[model samples]
Target chain A: MKDKTSKNQVLLKRQDFLKGMVAAPLVIAGLPNSAGAKPSASDAGNNVSYLFDSTKCIGCRSCTSACNQINDAELFSHDRPLDLSERSRTAIRVFLDDTKDKGTFIKRQCMHCLHPACVSACPVKAMRIDEKTGIVYNDPSVCIGCRYCMVACPFDIIQFEWDKKFPKIIKCTMCKETNLKTRGITACVDVCPSGALIFGTRKKLLAEAKKRIKKNPKKYVPKVYGEKDGGGTNILYIAGKDFDELGFPKNLGDESPAVITESIQAIYSWFIAPVVAFFLLFIPVSKNFKKVAGEENEG
Target chain B: MKKSEGSLAQQPLFGKIALAFVLLGLIIFLIRFFIGLGPTTNMSAGFPWGIWIAIDVVVGTAIGTGGFLMAILIYVFNKGSYHPLIRSAVMTSAFGYSIAGLSVIIDLGRWWNFYTLLLPWRWNTHSVLFEVAICILAYTIVLWLEFTPVLHEKGEDSGIMKIGFIKSIVNKLNEKKDGANKLLIVVITLGILLPIMHQSSLGTMMAIAKTKLHPLWHTPFLPILFLISIGFMGYSVVAIEALYSSFYLKRKYEVTMLRNLAPLTAALAVIWIAIRFFSLLSEGKAGLMSSSGTLSTYFWLEIIAVIIGTILMIAVKFSSSPRFIFISALFLIFGASLYRINVYIIGYNPGSNYNYVPSVMETMGTFALISAEFLLYLLFLRVLPILPAEHK
Candidate 1:
């Protein structure tokens, strides 16, 4: 009886292994065409962009105050004009230079990368980049206030309202809201006496940025900030000194961080495949136990 | 010895208290909806993720490692004798993950938009949390589906007396037990697959925080380390749950099954320690321990916990006492939780200027969550046929 049972178990094992081998490819083939099911590209808005030249910025808090007024937001501190507080969407950060050049001002806000980590990190379709202008914007209604976007931004440009009863994220939308809703241009650009912050298309700013660098090769650093950094951000920066001296993160690559991790995670998450594979493998592997249970039931 | 006829109607004292506690926690959670996380939590710009992300969701899901342990037994090891424990372990997993889901809803600032996470358009397949969320959600459904037969069996016998209308349907379904058992094999197999994917994805979440997380915990081998630790912790949770159930229910201990569990737990611990050292050496982060002034303390603390935890389990090879096994399992549990706490809280640093301390209320809320889970587990085992009948 034992020998006969052992033979039946061997047959069962062989059948299962064969079945699993046949089923494996079919399972992979049946997987939803993940690429085809991607989100619609129709939400792209106009390609409005920002050109920030650090040498021209006077560090005068005029742009910061203008952004607050344009956005109709409150100030964190009324004692002095706030510099990029939770309420202030954008401002100039001072990077004191001790070399031949005097101190320079660096504008701080979202880079609006061609491929953004914040948009990818938002569990909801809350954060998205406009296809037309490539402006990264957040829909507050859809935002769960997870602040994952803050962690994911390499530039550290995104700020949150920590003190508010119902806090929302604060970021430089390139005055897209004001420009799109009302015919008024970006408040920061409108108030800039030195023309430090310019509002235009990214293509125009890139051309303008290149012209300035070519005219005075000795005046600016060899690198163009946001040109190809983290997959080409819309907010371009031209500086007179080394980028890091002006508080920029050094050594960030052009490749989007989200792109690298997605393929690896997606493969393993297909739930139906592995579970089916396991059972096909197990039914034969546990034949001895099954036979024993079957015989015991008969007894 | 006295034997009592098992009826689903008899409610234990623990059951009533558990229900009351869940009710109270729900009320507090409702209040959290009107107000924001700022009022209820000590969350700041410096510390955006606090106890909710770390202890309640991360640690809570890890504690549900029992199902994984059972899966390894019944499927991988081909230990069919351990079948009875599968349903109960799965039920625990179901409840544990479902509560993690609930904690997530409570934690979100914009809870209304949570459906976006489920929307097909919003799936960020590359994201670790996305993978974790999808897997955990699917696993919760799979777990309850797998445990339904246990309910149907009990309902067939006494569901009429406890709840009248449900019995007739259960009586009809009981006759189809053979077909259902075949379906159960697929469900149980999913129980095994979901954890392996999601638990590793959980580790992948911290791996992406390479810039923010401390160097000691942040290594490329982080996912592998997380996988090993979760498997070890899962076995430990199974041991802890079984031991607790044995004590409270006054039933004969399943020493034979529990004995086999130690070797697997020990093996995973050894693997966990090996990778921890290898990754640190290769990454050249060995020097960070001495260089870091304050974080150095936590580095040593994590190292000691893993080392001492593995050593305790090793000692049990010579000593056969259940107490030693329990203590060793506790060490493993402590080690795993510390690893999570260290990665999420102690090691994470956004910048130098800001400081944050978790408010007392945040800690209390975490305590309430844990208390509530334990209370339900007690209530569930008594009311539902969660525990197996004592062997005659």
Candidate 2:
């Protein structure tokens, strides 16, 4: 009868320990907003943005040439760059339908997303957002050139310097440090003859995109491409055809990649903290428990 | 009560072949460094990552997970009978992670700036890759510390007193062994925690590439799936290593212990497959299986590999045979490796035009890495007291 009571007591203690181990992590994981909560949309309004009107574009390569002249050396061989490369920060991609009749020229560059996936994916903080200008920038010196940003980018705008022995990621910086500082605007916007590329604050550009769509419902696609796609890109687009038909990524919903990753990571981090604590505590606790059990066996 | 497991392997033929591959791979690596990635690799702007990141770092680390999984069984769960397997498991993990670290440097475009990964101020905590990198680095250190007892044991047995300089170092290490043993519980606990963190983070790294990755592989449940599958792969690797060591080195087969392990792995495999299918169904991505393409083919191949592996493992007839157990392990490793490859390469669609095929040099580099791992494993088994003195 005494042995049975002691055995039950031991079982109860073990169960209590197990319960503590499980509950500790649950409590920690439920901690209020451990990973900083998502930024409100109003907080992103001050960012620098681009307004690209595909209806007005003539497929001319002036912006591409201007971007090359500003960002790259004179060693570029192409007369009209068809795609964004290490030397080409931006390009004009011509998308045609099955019949090849309804052609649309989309100017491609960095989206500078409000919740940029590149910024979230970089192991090192080489890819950062400027607090003052709200422009995403890449620091080549600090970058280990993992190219994870290139993989994470939904717009597929980031390019790599594959030709260089010491490579760096290449993308549009909105002329923040160079042209915007020295010449007051971006080189591509300045050289655009068709008035397709316009640079302004995100709020103003978004309003302009909405106004263009509202004024000409039949002429435009009745939507702003970057307003909610991938949780809102700073670069806004207005096209005549549906954005998906014009080769824009359609599957990326309104949630930011950062939100998706961070939410999961936050929960993991919370749970890991308590689990690690349990393991650390288990060392001493188990030592004492073993001693007691050993005594019991001896007795 | 302790017994010796086995002695050093006598055959040098395997080691010699591995060395030749290593040398050939070194030449190609030099060419890669001097001529640039463009001339040497098939990687382009569209596909920045290739087999190095897919096979070496991602799958390679999963292969290394044997140590932590065994640590959990023997230490955390107090399954002391499995203790003999822990040293070999830790040794293999050390080699695996160290090679993965080396592969990371080789894959980096600016290899010279690799130190930035260690800089605390440079860390991006928001990034999943950051967590993986830090956890892997910490785990490698933990693994080395855990393996130190073998070195101390070797020093004590192999007459380290005859060597003047070596004697002092060994003595110092021996003197600290008691304290290390006391702290070993903590180290073993860390070993368990770190792999769980990093292995899952590896899958989380892909979460950011939602649009680029195929619907078949890119689910929010990736972290959990990766964690469970790696647990399965870890045990499989342990079984394969034990069986190979027994066959090649003329050691006694550890069939009884492995028999217990096979069922656990088979159960985990079922859980992994079920979770995969359930996630696909829940996410409404089951329609992707109907698409007659390379992506679907690779997906089905992964599924079939796991199914076959589980079948081989669960079969009552195969439970006692080391040879069958080894074959089952191979299938598990293959399935896990193919899953990583499919997620990172085959299932990845940056666009319709973008395609990547590893160059001969790139393929040689991967082969070199595996060969190096085998060679090192052999060397450590011979020199260090990694294996038990004999099978109990």
Models 1 onward score TM values of 0.83, 0.90
lDDT of 2 by residue, B87-134 (tens): 888989999999998888888998888789999889776788888888
True-vs-predicted CA distance for residue A253, candidate 1, Å: 3.9
Give each model's whole-structure lDDT. 0.69, 0.80
Residue A287 in model 1: lDDT = 57
TM-score of chain B of each: 0.89, 0.93
**Candidate 1, superposed: residue stretches over 4 Å from native:** A1-47, A73-86, A95-104, A159-169, A210-221, A240-242, A266-299, B1-27, B156-172, B389-392
- Which candidate has the top score in TM-score? 2
Which candidate number maximizes lDDT? 2
Residues A1-299 of candidate 2 have per-residue lDDT tens digits of 34544565466445434434454344334322213223445556767777999999998888887777766756454568777778788888998977988789999888888778899889899998776556888998889889999889988889988877877888999888767888878888888898998988888988888998899999998889888888788888999888887767768988776765765565444345637665675675356435433443464
| Residue A141 local lDDT, model 1 | 76
Docking class of 1: incorrect
